[model samples]
Target chain A: MEDNKIQEVKSPSLITTPSGGWGASVHVFAPATVANVVCGFDVLGFAVNEPGDEVIMRMTGKPGITISKITGDDGRLPLDPAKNTVSVSVQHYLQSVGRADVGLDIELHKKMPIGSGLGSSSASTVAGLFAIKTLLGDEADPAKLLPFAMKGEEMACGQGHADNVAPALLGGFVLIRSYEPLDVVRLPHPAGLWCAIVFPDVDVPTREARQIIRKNIQMKDAVTQWGNIAGLVSGLFMQDIDLIGRSMKDVLVEPVRSMLIPDFYKMREMAMGMGAVSFGISGSGPSVFAFTKDEETARLITQKLQQHLTGLKIGSNTYVSTINDAGPRVLG
Target chain B: MEDNKIQEVKSPSLITTPSGGWGASVHVFAPATVANVVCGFDVLGFAVNEPGDEVIMRMTGKPGITISKITGDDGRLPLDPAKNTVSVSVQHYLQSVGRADVGLDIELHKKMPIGSGLGSSSASTVAGLFAIKTLLGDEADPAKLLPFAMKGEEMACGQGHADNVAPALLGGFVLIRSYEPLDVVRLPHPAGLWCAIVFPDVDVPTREARQIIRKNIQMKDAVTQWGNIAGLVSGLFMQDIDLIGRSMKDVLVEPVRSMLIPDFYKMREMAMGMGAVSFGISGSGPSVFAFTKDEETARLITQKLQQHLTGLKIGSNTYVSTINDAGPRVLG
Candidate 1:
């Protein structure tokens, strides 16, 4: 009966095809993101060029959801669709877009390392949900689908935050205006800008890192933070690169979070001296990222960061990326 | 002797001519500014369209400085250039630009009322310095001129702050990045937005009002303040009106300062409910300003604020303004 049902729906558009067939399957890739870009704190994020996740979604001839493949993870992720981040994210998308009857077979390629401060789990969730929506013929808007993906990320990180998922799904620089009901604003990508991301071989789980932050901040520090964020946003809009560099200060979060990253302050100083426009800890960070004006500066800064990490007896990987304008896309 | 000195210099530039001379010294107008836009605390400011201070500079052949005329100030302002805000500002500018030998007959048209929480002193200083520079063939850049003008404001307010003065001089939404050396960033001004300024006939001196503020703020509150500022700046860059409204919360300064303004909370609620994007005490005030997307809404908000003040037995003057892009312009 399942074979007969598959034969009946032979269209290229995934939206019209029935859900009970393996033929209506597709792969998706979603880029990793940098959250809390300096002064932005909890509001701003952007997608990077490398170290992304791959998600394959196939419509199983079963009655419910299942996770068929989960390579690269240390055998910890669950196989049930309701328990796994990728499968659960797909389940959420199907439910939210009113396609609850669909049964999904999801295979997550966790290319980026976990606990890398590079939004690895968020990348997987965004890739899986986005692919499933496309396989269903793009029935949901990206903005509409983001909250569901963020929910799946919350299942992993134990908090609902869109700082990473918004950029991972939409690309470029994005501002999460509101978390309740999830509103996001995407700003124009400044031309001739590139980012150098350096991930050291150290693990700092988001939950453990977050636990170290003090519950309260001084009002004076907060004012300074707001001022910096205001300057940063205005700098981006004005395309004032110098102002952007000046405003990349984090008085509230970075001062506390930097204690967890070894040689963080030294690396930041070196990157700045090497002509980086700005430098900051990525996410909760064992990783760090620096922005520059051109490819030459970005390359120089990457080498500088890697050299410093090697001196500290830590292995490192570096990539130079322009702004990612294409967020999540079909693999074809 | 004054007439003889005036006749000695034949140049048309007022900055070059002696006081009581026939040569015209062109004075400029710099718009009044709204500082600390709600949640922005000490960081945000925007130039208003109407009700600006006028600087009248005439060349005096006299070897030293003299303020020849002071009108519209109810005879309260000093005629001596050494003691006056505008004159002191001019002297500071001349010293910074290495033009100390220049003699001037300066006049300040204090059109806007003092103690209005509308940056009256900063307007006067910016206008005076700007006019003097223009008269001297634009000898000083705004960046070099701001510190001097800011000093003039500090003379009146007891502290130097660029949140108002920078925007008043440059004419747009501005972010004060730092106080030392006065770093400023200009933000985009979305067209068609207007501000409604209501000045109740009550005096709250900047010195007295500042004393009421708490010296320390909680760290949690500070974090929320930065978050709101980030949201507001992002909203302005994206032109999201609703987001702008939501981000207009002040946890640090407003609660302390609002006690000086009678019916402050009522006035804010009335204006906000009437479609004002944001409303707050302009500086340290009995005066308050509300932002709106258009002139009509601004007018409506002005009326509502006026009505609220009237209910509290306070009389007020109201003005509507668009963003002033042309700041400190010389008038021949």
Candidate 2:
């Protein structure tokens, strides 16, 4: 609460405390994620740049949790640390390792647009818990923090899914093989892979986007989706971009979600015409992303999409960048 | 009509052609395949050794197909090469290249069981077409031979599926992602990965085995099956044998078809106990396979399975071999 406005740093370093240990005041940054990447439906995701969230934490003098500050989100996010995803995720982490009583003051810095289908909540959920885990000198796997992120994200999106959260936390390409045992596998990231993400200025909540999808998909379509999923994973591991392009076909969820996004068909057509390897919804709907092989092509694709949106008088923001390999880390 | 008895060779090399121009009497071998491969239903398969089929072929004078002799099948298979899977496959290959007039007198060698869920027909389908492809000096990719194999396999089993035929022709592990464009991805095989295949004395035709499966499966079960399929592919690529073991779970087809196999549960239990990474029905029923990391373990598992079958008074045949990496190679 002292320096209420701790300026967010593009390049952050760890803040050393009196103990001079790894667990002091830490600022962790988590990147935005693109889930349901074409063929991957609730199983595949990758982290992207530009829009993300940060969590600030410090070990408190007393032995309980406190929410000191949460900036930039307006009144959209909850104030109570118990009710917030950031601190709640920390709470879940602490409880899991039998350290729930650890005193800490939590802070949230929101940079990404909320409910934009860009894994905004997942970023906070990942960054918040990640900051505390580092501060507490916990050497456990970063993936161990994913379940907490999933729990925290459920409060924001009304679904406890790991696809977006995994990529937001682990970075690169992540595949959630099974949910029952919660098996997540990190796949090889192809070189020179660029992404053009366009978040159309529309308030399509994650809940509404999910509701549009049917409960039961056709068996044939499911076969196609799963086949593409296997092929997608294979292509990435084999480092074959052509196979990746051919495999990134989503036949199950995209058709239904496209109805919710305005001019979704045309938007995808323009992206595909510009030689995007894959073009489809990022997570659920509204926010669209396209994968390309080169950065220049990604930039051109982004500009074309923006120009088309400008012509239609629809407000939109586009981010052109490569897939983020370093997911949630300290940036000073 | 010369040499009705063409002696089969074990350590066979490439068959020398007349004038070294590729067209001469040649023998090609296709290993028996394990289709379905636990979780990949219609999309995954791998080849095993022994109990396979062979095709002996030579160019004909009148430019018309003929089946001179067939061994071991006991008249169940057709005498007409056009009707036989081996010759039918050659016919498909001929029509595809607009060289249907290129005739071949053929002989079939049925080494594998006829209808015991061991990919007997698939072996014939692959070897027959492969022999002709080699004899005609067709420089087509081995993968291009799959559709013809599918055509031939269909005649033998009354169902056209490349799951078995692809692996039989190409060898090792094969993933058929999509059938429309016939996208088949050959996966990496872990070194020393041995297969213990036990063909119990039972008659379960490929058609009847397929008939027992429900047309429309529950959506929940489909998700599980596809998830495991993706996991299996990933495991093979990453060379994570434990992950492969965990992912070899089949939730869709195995449960329904296991009813036809005697002591199916007990067989899997013994195999799993003997350190088999994966154990399940090889293709349809009666024929069971277990994947092990070493040859010694594979032998032990096979012995245990054979003993169990013997105790049950069920006649059976067992074969232990690593993945046949050299698929359908030229034999001298």
Candidate 3:
């Protein structure tokens, strides 16, 4: 029956047929991202090495898309292709390329925790899209797929911003210059710069975390925020680690969002006291990240933070890695 | 009697004596600056080569400060030592160094239009400070005098911001990362960038220009503004001219301030249509500026803008130059 179905696929392009047949499969891994980057709010983000997501996609003869499996999400994610971010985003990408008739099966493996404020959904969505792109032998730039990935983000969260998906797609530090035309630029950074991310096992809903932020910020505070944003970008371009640390300050969102995570201030003090260069809440919070100059310090700070979270009787996970310079890669 | 005044002075530092006498004079030139730089608001600025001010300072045996002459200001500037920005700022520097009793005479030559929004007062104040520093053989870094220069800014305008004074004193493009501790850093830029400045003969009081701006802005707009700020800084660092042009957009202040300048939108259209890279209000702005790649284009844009202002029955002044890498220099 499956062989008979293969005959019905009308001329799947030669580029899509590696073995001159329809059962080609590809696997891809996409890095998780940290958005806002302290003072940047919705304008800045970066990719990290660990706690990412993997997607396996295979071409089928049927004229539709299906999600075969989703793991490590504790049944929190929807299995329906209509409701799932990965399948929905892949469908969007297919339609965009005039390949809506292509049939595929997707499997999302969440290597990271869900709702950790570590861009888990963005990672999954990017991974799925990357897998499909790889399977179809598409030669388009990965950044060209960003808009489709952002659609998945819009479905996962209420607002459609490129901060998370951009870094996750392009790698390194990314500055979203504008949203109207969707301008995103990759910035330079110090080679030795490292990030220490700790995801505390606290549930801070994305909607409520966003709602807690002041929509109407004071003009003076806004000036301070932009100053730091300019400084951070300058620091990155200059490759001055100390300046980057000094500029990693948030006067708008963190002050309010920090309240959602228990012992947030104490953890920050500990991180700074342990020689971390800078500290701030990641994404919408419950997860937080600190920066350091070397892998040793990054690991030490993460261990210290995880210990502090344990002292508060809260479970936590820790990861220490330099910035992920390569966004995504074919695993097999 | 003239010789008797020198004997009355208590042991002055030998560094102050250049000709083995109490009488020494120094002349200095300080360039004008463009603050806000479009999207930067209060955090970014850069120096320009033309339309600057000159200060001539002469050490005297008398035990007080005096403003001996002022020129080219249409008698709009004050000659009183206590009231004038140059003399007032010089006094602050003198008091800081515990040399308030040292006698000096200052001559301010306003080479640029007064209240042109081209940082006229900042150029004058920086010139005076530079003149004093050079005359005294003070080998300290020129940036150390920024606070003294900022005092003159506070006296000229109500607020004390480093956007103008920092670039005027430090040269090159500058970013004021924070105000509390006054962190200012110079940024690198492409060598070929040129500016076309046009100061229309009109009044747009700095205080009123500031007052007209919204005190509280929507978070979305602030995000957009900071995104552009980051993009501009990154563009400067990357030496990407088109990126810089695309990022030189102001969502907060320019909307309100443009109303003050006649035919502001039309002028912007003309400049942009004529191959200008970017255009915006230079400071609080009766003065406007556009950036171009070469000297010829800069001069042509300025000429065209002046003609447009002339069509409106308004008088104007125009200057064209590249970014000023040297902030202030000793004339003699």
Candidate 4:
């Protein structure tokens, strides 16, 4: 333990294994997330079961990293690892762990629609870094990997925020307590809380959705939002379904972001009128979500929402899931 | 059931009786409270055990209200029903519940220091209105009386905010979810959560405190503050003492208002260093509070805080108690 002397460490075997350890490959799946989740603007989020991403990674035989295959996405995602959201996150993780020289092969599957306001980029990024995390044998607490996810977001959207990635990576409900310090908390997840999301076949780019928002909000709005944020957190923990429904309202972010979604007000009204507990834009978007108490209610609402969309003559995807408690997992 | 027909009722006896009922007098006590409760500005607060107000009131001989007596303080409180904080609230309550014709006699005991950041005016007002509420056969919910308390604050502080009066009236930790419709929620109380407060012989008027704070906050600060507010609420509900301690931070209000309190920084540092789970200005300034897990820790902190003030020639009063669950009660 001499001062300033390097400590001894065990060396890994160079030989490849059949499973995803060291030289072998691993497949990781990260769920899609709903950011802002009503009252929490840039702060609260939760994971859903449908619309996620899958990434495959392994130590490469040659130097540096290689992108072997990309699926689901129609050539929209970049091939270069540096330009891709998932690969960029892997790079950040590798560099931070002092393993930048580690050569890797990567593959990505974008199951969720790109630019659909369903946390597509964050899902892919979470899957990528998480896949690598398993191969590298988990050094840091899983929450520590959030910064790498932000790096992925920065590479993909040119701005970084954790509202999506935190929940996508850690599951349950997560609050981004502070951005400058990058602190996140996993709130107590309530049982029987289900979510229904309708992803309309429309695109609202994250960058453009962000640009329309005012840099400063009225203090009046801030106070309303503050109380609701507290109420929303309480609703989730207390497991009071009506309280959660009433609290899941967005006065600050949705009023500004809702312009991008067509018939946003009518759809929200329909959801609420049809027994959805609370309704709001999921992330920045064309995708909207409603929270309900039961799977039957969620399914009924999803059918009505889909039937309502028939008038527009566009194919839309609707999903109902219990709040995803397990965030990312290795594909067995 | 007859349209626009006035219903006949029995005439009341002229003489006022001993107990505050239809023909008697009733004595009511309301406790002074600390608003903002740290990270929640204009949104959160709780009741303290010591330094509160008492009011005595009952039906009068005449068809109007009378301020029979006022004691304590430097004669700042008014006697006129409209001008006095207590009387105006009583007036508002009577008029609101269609009991405006009922006469009332009122006496106020300013047991707590006025302008001490101890919710002096709010306590007196709450007591006066609540006394009448108990006497009126209790038709309206107790929370319905909050507006009358706010009317009192309006007369006293020139602006009405419910943070102080809500906790004083309801007891325990309270969150003002929406001010417009005036939605208030009583959050779940944490077990073994004790609060300690110290009042130095200094006055920082509520008006002055309100003036110093910047109406608009930076978006970055708002996000951080939002997270802390949610965390504080969660901490309280979950009964996580450490989490509550970590979340009781005042980035928005303290920096501005603390300028008015002498040695504020030193006092806060000393309290935190002494194992205060969280420490900050109780409501505005001159009074500071901390939350601790054990009563012994709270007692120790209070004693040391009082001792630390020995050299300053300022006599300070310190109090500690488990978070006040029962807000205000009548004394026999």
Candidate 5:
């Protein structure tokens, strides 16, 4: 394989080279992220170890861009460039960078389940935009690329929230200051920290979950929420594991959202009792996640949660994951 | 100076000796602290260098407590130990530890002006409790002592607020997570940080200030406040000074409180333009505090604020200070 030539051609459009083909192809994988990590609400998120999406982009001779392949979504994803989130994101980025005429064929692998509270859509969006940027060479920075990819997430969630996308794209615990100019800062992630995420066979529409919440909250509750967030942020900085556990509490969002999850209270208590430091609904959930210091505790808590749900006769899929450091990577 | 004799003074009650008595006496100074550093609302606070109070507790004759001398407040402070905030706090701590009947004579030297937005009452309470604890050979732990002192503040503010008291008791940047169990955490204070506190001649009584706030806040505003708080916490942890400045905004409280401070908008803008990392009303203000990177900037910002007020024909007093690491110490 030539160093500059496209490798592992999976898209039909790439077979015939375009007029401006740089003979280079790009593949990007963005890790799955867990948003609203318990008390973190809108400010906290971390990338997960497994279950991510991959996107490959190649300069092509096709009249217009096309998503030739999208596996793992049961053929539900759109192939036409304009109707797809990934394609739309890429288009936005290209236009921003003055490269709108660049033609490319893209392939997306939806490895994670959609609407799973695992930042599935964000992963795909990040993966697609990242791949296109890689193929276009280093013409854009991650900060510039983020808003474009986040627009894809906005399509899924109705509003663009970067709590999940930022971490998935940047590969660490990220704080999104604002989505306007897309201000984000990455904080340190402690080593050996693993999270146990349990996705029960239940679904809660994000819109419905958000609707149950009050449009206005008492000023007192707001104060409490900010206090918890402050503690959580400080906990991460000091590396005080116990403080981190204590700080992962949400008074504003979880009470309303938890009603949608089965045995939410019991599962959270069980997790904590079984050595999980903290537990909260993952994003706008039917899924819940908990943090543990070690794999043994993670496994123990996972088993405890599974046992609690046995009466419901529903199987729970559990994943014990370390923090994903490499958010997105190229795979040829 | 006998160790056993000091041990016998189990509570503040046992330190009834006058200031000139033969028994050893301890005078502790606790600096005034700015609580709720803007976005932190109820969670963040840092101790300031200037305008601190002195508490002088000494052994005396009778086994009954008396606030022997109150030099500040223009002789308005209650001389009765039972009525004073500091003495009551000491009493509470003693009772909590099952040593409530010790006698002492306490002399409070008020260094900071009351109602100056410098946590004058909290400093007095912390200094008194701390001095008595030290004189009795008790290990002074602010975390354990804050709730007791907070009760005294409740008498003054009509509520127990740890924003100021926590930092005054425990030096550095402190977070008040909860008041029920009095959970507080001391967050890291970045190096070379200095605060310039400007006290314009005005008074916004804490009680009246509390009345002006709306009981209900729009959920949108609450979320923005929490996001900013999270950013502020992340900035402090990552030592990203720029983010810290951006996050110090308080959309909920400052807008309402700023009305009470003369020329607040102009002062804040001047401070920020002058390179203040963060600026906000210092606790139910009439006083405003701004953070800078160095002593030079601190001095420059203070002078700038003074100049701004001069232009407005509003007299203002400003003090340049570093983060007070020693919260409360023996003055002698």
Candidate 6:
């Protein structure tokens, strides 16, 4: 690994393509993210290790961005470059860097379920952007890509929230400290932290889930929510798992959103009974997640939750993994 | 300091008094605290080094709690033990430990201003409780006295909130994560954090200050507030002064409460101009605090704020100190 005699791969790229373009194609994978983590509402999220999306990008002679192929989206995602979140965000990135004239062929592979409340669109968008940046050999900081990804989020979901896209782009647990200034802080997490995710097959539109929440909340509830929010963040810093469990409560959003998800309370009770550290709706939700201290408990929680969903005659996908420390990775 | 030949003080006490009583008197000092810290509202507070209360307690031959003397309020405080916060809290503590028969006389010395929005009553109550505990040489945990101290808060403030008392008892910055189970977490802080507190002369009752706030708040504002709360806590842990400054904004309470204080916005503007890290109304109204990196800046800001208050023909007191790491101490 320390061999200085290793051949430089980028020298060949400079001969084949223009100054800003890559000679070879690049494939990138971005992890799925869980937004609105319990009491965090529109501020906090974390990326998971499994169930992500992949994007393949390569420069071409044609002048414009195009989606050559898209898979596993059930033909629901847009094919047009202007309309699709992946292409639109990538186009924005290219425009910002004065490379809008660069031609590119993009292929999106949705390895995760759509509308699963697990930041599916964010994964796809981040993967596409990461692929382009990798191909260009861009040394710019990864956080610089967040605004473009948030634009993708705005296109996908009417709101430009960073809870999902920020974590998907930066990895680990993230706190969107401010929206106007777009201050996103990547926080430290306990090494033993594992997430148990269950995407139950239920048709709950994100718009409808958002509409169901109360626009005006009591001051008492807001006080409670911020307290828990502080506690959860403190727990992450202190690496105290029990404090995290105690503080992962959502009195504002969960009470109303839970009505859309069948057996939400029952699943929470069962998850907690099985030693799950904390459990709550993931994002706007038909999906849910439970935090655990070990991989074994996380796996057990997913298994039990999937079984419960099955008993209700509902299909579900389950995943057990630690937090994704690295945001996006390059694939051959 | 490591000498094992140090005299054991408890041996002489055992011969003169019964199991639950002490022969000698104890004098205690508890630091004043700033509650409702910016975006934290009712859930966060921290102790300051100056302007605290002192309590002197001694065991008597009589059988009940008594307030023998009260000073520094111009006779505003009550002499009756049942009505006074200090004696009432100490009585509750005595009852909880099955020592109601243990006689006590507490002298209340108000070192801090009353109703200055600086938790004056909480300091006195905590000081009284700490004095009794010290006299008895109680080996019980300090946190065990929180419930009893909170009763005094209920009598003084009409709400059993622990934002003031918790920090006064535990020292440092504290977060009351939940009110039901009464969970308090002491958070880490930046070592060089200094506070500039200016208590302007005004008559803003706590009840009226609270009643002025909107019971129902917009969801967007709540989200913003919690994001700032998380950011503030994270900044404290990460020791990021800039992040803490950016996140100390309070959109809900400050807007309404600032109206009660004269020239609140102008002071904030002046303090920010003078290199203060953050500025906001401390506790509720009348008193305001500015955070700064060093003691010199804190002292300067307080002087300017006091000068401004004087220009308006309003009397004010100023304090410059670091966060009090120790909650209460024996004066003698």
How does each model score on lDDT? 0.78, 0.79, 0.87, 0.79, 0.78, 0.88
TM-score of each: 0.89, 0.91, 0.95, 0.88, 0.91, 0.94
Q: What docking grade does candidate 6 earn?
A: medium
Clashing pairs in 3: none
Sort all candidates by lDDT, best to worst: 6, 3, 2, 4, 1, 5
Candidate 2 positional error at B86, Å? 1.0
Error of 1 at B94 (Å): 2.0
Q: Which candidate is the best by DockQ?
A: 6
lDDT of 5 by residue, B52-140 (tens): 99988876655667887898789778887778898888888767766555667888899888888889999999998887667666653
Which candidate do you rate higher for DockQ, 2 or 6? 6
Q: Name the TM-score of candidate 3.
A: 0.95
User: Global CA lDDT of candidate 2, please?
Assistant: 0.79
With candidate 6 superimposed using the best TM-score fit, by how many Å does residue B92's alpha carbon deviate from the native? Answer: 0.5
Q: What local lDDT score does residue A41 receive in model 5, on the 0 to 100 scale?
A: 69
* Model 4 chain B weakest lDDT span, ten residues long: B1-10
Task: After the best TM-score superposition of candidate 1, give how far the Cα of residue B241 lies from its true spot, in angstroms.
Answer: 3.8
Q: Each model's DockQ?
A: 0.45, 0.46, 0.77, 0.56, 0.64, 0.80
TM-score: which is higher, 3 or 5? 3
Sliding window of 10 residues with minimal summed lDDT for model 5 chain B? B1-10
Q: Of the candidates numbered 4 and 5, which has the greater lDDT value?
A: 4
Per-model chain A TM: 0.91, 0.91, 0.94, 0.92, 0.89, 0.94
Restricted to chain B, the TM-score per model reads 0.90, 0.91, 0.94, 0.91, 0.90, 0.94
Proportion of true inter-chain contacts also present in candidate 2: 0.43
Worst 10 residues of 1 chain A by lDDT: A1-10
